[model samples]
Target: MVQVKLFDCEHEQDLEEEINRFLSDLEHKQVVDIKYNIAALREAEDEQIYCFSAMVMYIK
Candidate 1:
């Protein structure tokens, strides 16, 4: 089976940490693949927000 989820964070460190935590909770060593894309959202000339879309694939 395969599963995908989206994670959002303001900093890179937070995003990475959350991903790791999620993987750990799954406790599956046979993860097929993990992928993600990050984009910066602009609210103002000097303001930005980070959005991440993460996908996790594993064997059921």
Candidate 2:
């Protein structure tokens, strides 16, 4: 079986933390693959905010 999870946050650190917590809960499962995507949410003068999404595939 395969499982997937998505996580996004205003800050990259927050997103990473959320992903970590989610993966931790699946420790009993064997992970087959993991993937992620990141994109800018809005345009700014010189900086931009980011959003992230992650997918986890595992065997049950």
Candidate 3:
């Protein structure tokens, strides 16, 4: 399994788009499974700054 973490995603749509892009890029590979999680956005110390995390898993 390969894990990819995406941070600072703007919204659900962005996350979905990124996932689709990744999957498309790996279309020719022997991927057995794929999963992802988007973490809630939180303040990043700087005012008006927020961030989120997405975790993706790929299995072969």
Report per-prediction Cα RMSD to one decimal: 2.4, 2.4, 4.6
Model 2 C-alpha lDDT per residue in residues 1-60, reported as the tens digit of each score:
666655667777887888778778776547777788888756767677777777777776
Q: Which runs of model 1 end up more than 4 angstroms from their true locations?
A: 26-29
Better of 1 and 3 by lDDT: 1
- TM-score (C-alpha, index-matched) for candidate 2: 0.67
lDDT string, candidate 1, 1-60, tens digits = 655655767677888888888778676765778777889878877787777666777654
Instruction: Please estimate how well model 3 matches the true structure, expressed as its whole-model Cα lDDT.
Output: 0.56
Evaluated at residue 38, the lDDT of candidate 2 is 85
Better of 2 and 3 by lDDT: 2
Candidate No. with top TM-score: 2
Task: After superposing candidate 2 on the true structure, give the runs of residues whose Cα lies further than 4 Å from its correct spot.
Answer: 44-47
The alpha-carbon deviation from the true structure for residue 18 of candidate 2, after best TM-score superposition, in angstroms, is: 0.8
Model 3 quality (TM-score)? 0.45
For each candidate, give its TM-score against the true structure: 0.62, 0.67, 0.45
lDDT of 3 by residue, 1-60 (tens): 555544347576777787677777665554554444544444667445334345555553
**Would you give me the overall lDDT of model 1?**
0.73
